[model samples]
Target: MPQPMGQTGGWESYPLNPAVHPGKKVVFQYTAEMEVKTLVFTLIDKGHE
Candidate 1:
């Protein structure tokens, strides 16, 4: 779920299953009252380098 951080929209985080295959497709759905300026997605690896 998306979380409201402040006036600048919000962020959401989901834990991917270890068995999830690469190149998997993801879909996001939302409604906004105003024109969305920007959308960013980031993936972080928490395992050891």
Candidate 2:
């Protein structure tokens, strides 16, 4: 899913695919006019480890 960013906001969070498995390559893209300051991948496991 391509989550479009607003012009005024500096941060946003996009929901990851539930079917996403390990070793999958997720691509994050933005427009040329948009400036990317930082990128982070967060994984939260609430189930049994």
Candidate 3:
């Protein structure tokens, strides 16, 4: 499911199900009223630590 970023867009996070493995490709679809300058992705270790 895609979540809306709302009118005031700053930062939003989405979790990947089944996780992403090596040799896999992830695609994102974004719609914004204004021009998008930068997009960033951060990986978090949810495994046993």
- Candidate 2 Cα outliers beyond 4 Å, as residue runs: 1-9, 21-33, 45-49
lDDT of 3 at 13: 46
lDDT of 1 by residue, 1-49 (tens): 5546555455444444547633232323233533444444434442522
Q: Regarding lDDT, does 2 or 3 come out ahead? A: 2
lDDT of 2: 0.49
lDDT (10s digit) by residue, model 2, range 1-49: 3455665324455656658643233344454466655565554443523
Cα RMSD for candidates in order: 6.0, 6.6, 6.7
TM-score of each: 0.33, 0.41, 0.30
TM-score of 2: 0.41
The CA lDDT of each predicted structure is 0.43, 0.49, 0.44
User: Backbone clashes per model, in order?
Assistant: 0, 0, 0
Residue 47 of model 2: what lDDT? Answer: 52
Query: Where does candidate 1 stray beyond 4 Å?
Result: 1-4, 21-43, 46-49
